[model samples]
Target: MSKEQGRTWDTSLFKRVFSFTKPYGGLLAIILTIITVLAILGPLRIALIDHMVHHFIEAKDLAGLRTFALIIVGILLGETFLNFATTYLSQKLGQSIVKDLRNQLFSHITKLRLKFFDKNPIGMLVTRAVSDMETVAQIFSQGFLSIIGDILVLVFALTMMFVINWQLAFIVLIPIPLLIIATNIFKKAIKKSFQDVRKEVSALNTFVQERITGMALVKVFGRSKREAKTFSEINNRHKKANIRSIWAYSIFFPVVEILSGLSLGLLILYTLSRVDDPGVNFGELAGQLTAFIMFINMIYRPIRMLADKFNTLQMGLVGAERVFKILDTDELIPNTGKVIKHDFKGGLSFKNVWFAYNNEDYVLKNLNFEVEAGETVAFVGATGAGKTSIINLLGRFYEFQKGSIEIDGEDIRDIELNLLRDNISVVLQDVFLYSGSIYDNVTLGNPEISKEQVVEAAKLVGAHEFIDRLPDGYDFNVKERGGLLSVGQRQLIAFIRAYVYQPKILILDEATSSIDSESEMLIQNAIDKLTKGRTSIVIAHRLSTIKNANKIIVLEKGEIIEMGSHAELLQQEDGAYRKLYETQFDGHEV
Candidate 1:
């Protein structure tokens, strides 16, 4: 059982769920009115039957019987129409609220910082946005309003039974207290079961999603049997959770049926005792007994369903609480800067910078660097030497703990987040392409970028030759993550995408590290054209790639030990850059 199952009906959460209905107030009022009328019609039909039996059927008046039967039939038709309207309108209201809530949830997630995604799993989020939202919809369509209609029916039925014959009504209600106690027990048990079911469902989704995405790795490592066994275990847990709810239902429903039967038996025994009364008319008494039986059935029908509806309401409230927790998160990157510059100069400087993924265990310690506008600066370091961390800090994907990063002498924090990112583009080693046509991927659904502009950018970056070789040229569809394309081909597409944006600053992080010699040559030529006039930052494992850079900075343990041109740095016999170059090209340790 979840912690939330211990609490009573959360009135504030209930109010929050209903608040989404404010936009459809008129429709809700109409649904309520229909439900009330439907409630009245149920008992009214029973009264009509009792009256016809006493006035027409008992007297053997056939003509009056025919007329009264038609009247009841007409009321039945109207009641049916009202039932249909209430069902249709309530579902419409529920779906509308779900749509709005999902939109808000998705929008809020998009604005959250990257750190949030790093900490949360994508499959858990997918369950919250999709399945949980559907559960919340049931609070309107199947849970709350249906329970209200059922209660109103009970109220009218009870009032009519007492008005016709008070003594019989009292006898029929003798077993109701026991039924109420049973219902309360059922509600608590079922609610705990539902909470378990929801938790298991989230776990199931997360496990399946991760395994499917990593299927290739599992097969390559020959762990298929192991993964299959793990999946079966998760599947069994989900099955067990649902079985718990089924167990509660199996016991509770039978108990309701038994109590309802006991109430009918009590009513019949009491009526038999009053049959020989001197003042009572047999016909009138028989009609009253019949009407009371109908009333008992009507009352017990809703009572039997009340436990199930209450469980649905509880589950929806649980789902809402989970979704609201995410919506309430305060981890969004602040975008309060008012500065917007159309022609941004890409001179960058970092002074006394310190950063870490967590706490003060810094990855880059007191780092300092400067890049003049339109200068190409290269950074060479081993893995985990704070290379990618610099790109993340510059884009404000993560925050730095100390010191300042400035662009064109203005602090990056003072610049609008979107505007600052718009002026820079980074092409990483692992390129991600959405499932769409090449044209769509290149433009990324932006209306401002024309097909001609995309074509021009492709030609400039030498990507047009391969793209033109495809059957559909720019119209070719690239499946998920560009799985159909080779590594070099995908890199070429990334270069074209970056070039089309015409960013003032360009970042290439291991862009040429994984490809054939021919593809690397093509990308190298494309890189020369791309960085000709833009401020560029290059991170490379290969020492030959950055020989022409204006300045080469060698970093070891997050601090720069050497900075100069390639020849100048090589001239120093003990320099880090000289040693790294010799290890790669001369095939020896220095």
Candidate 2:
């Protein structure tokens, strides 16, 4: 893929992330309050140590010293308990925020129109749902919480140090501006590096998934060596990006360490010069020294944390952008229509419909067709002759640009999408079986159905016989995408799925194309029973399968050039249907 065609996570990411917190405003507020308390305790500990050195040590009072030691121990224990509590609360809040994000993202993506999926691969979408959602979860789960604590601590430490001794604070802070500038510069470079790393990662993910899916083809073609080389090239790019990121951090962390160390050395030199002139007390010197060292240690950590988070944040932001990109896709066909809640009484008509994938060119143009209640109409055409497109339109997968589709007497545009789809069942050319028991896959179409109903549906589709042949029968576990089953068996299961729905309208888009002769015959009989009292639109390649269809429409290019019963079209001289029949049946008995 070209760089121009692919995209990284977008830049305007913070606003999107912060928006997720809106729904969980209450939990976030409590988390913030705990964070603020944690921050204030930063300077409080330093100040306590300073006071112990100056007052207790100078007074040479063992009793006072003992009391101070006890106070220090108590503060340590309190902070320990507070740390655990705050951590628990932050985790709970983070998980809540991520759950809300995942829910919104899931709902939004599922509602996106088909054209979105047409262009985006299933692998990329899987990345968004799994990897991207996990990334966002981590950002909220740990990164944001840590950042909050760091920011607050930095703020309190800076303020208290300045108040304690103005001159020393000014001298110590000289390195602060330089450190900030260095970190900001490092941040941009590292963010870009990590962004490159993430892009390469997604590319690798896409590449591996695509190859695994095409493994059979690759093995047959003997192209494993070439494919491995290609994979290695991509993997190496990812490696380089990771190495560069590590190098950037290596330079950045040690630089922070040195700058912070230098600040301490300068502060000590300045304090020593003052002590001789003012005849400073030993205990007072020790007190100031302890406070200064603690403040310097505090400064370096938050700086490093602030810098490091950008690495995680940028990667997560890019992931989030991809997820949101899918969510933000426009609906190609909006449902401004009324909900089709009541069962459809079948009558479906397409009035002079002109449809196109890109909307500019025609796949089906000015086409007019209608199926009466309980009619079984077959669309038989050569590949890419707009046969499947007809089924797509019937299922409301795509809307016509130049004409209207009506169901029963009402325009389909006026029907709520779910309500319209509720009474329609589509069996596509591709039979996707999930990794689960036979019963799980069959009943997936309508889980509320009874066990007996599932078995009945399976028997009707001729799936039960082979299902029973399996080790666990209906409970047989299918591997990934039902790879464990033969293609024909999978198709039979898909048939059972469609039949179980008992939809008002049935769409069979080459549904029987993958199965064997025996299974196909069984599927044909099942279809005959299933479509007994329903409207069925079938697009089939096997001319024999549609021989019994009540009406047959043959398309050439984007228009229907011929139409009649199987017998009527057969009798026409060199009719389009006759040519199709001759091609398929001439080679093999139809």
Model 2 residue 72 lDDT?
A: 81
Candidate 2 segments whose C-alpha is farther than 4 A from its true place: 1-13, 138-145, 587-590
Give a tens-digit lDDT track for model 2, residues 315-381: 5666677777777777646877666566679888889999998957999988888889899999987
Off by over 4 Å in 1: 587-590
- Please report the TM-score between candidate 1 and the true structure: 0.95
Find the 10 residues in a row with the least total lDDT in model 1.
581-590
Which pairs, if any, clash in model 1? Answer: none
TM-score against native, each model? 0.95, 0.93
Clashing residue pairs in all predictions, respectively, total: 0, 4
- The stretch of ten residues in a row with the least summed lDDT in candidate 2 is 1-10
Cα lDDT, model 1, residue 427: 88
lDDT of 1 by residue, 43-144 (tens): 999888888887888888899999889989998999999999989998998899989999999999988888899999988999999889988998988899
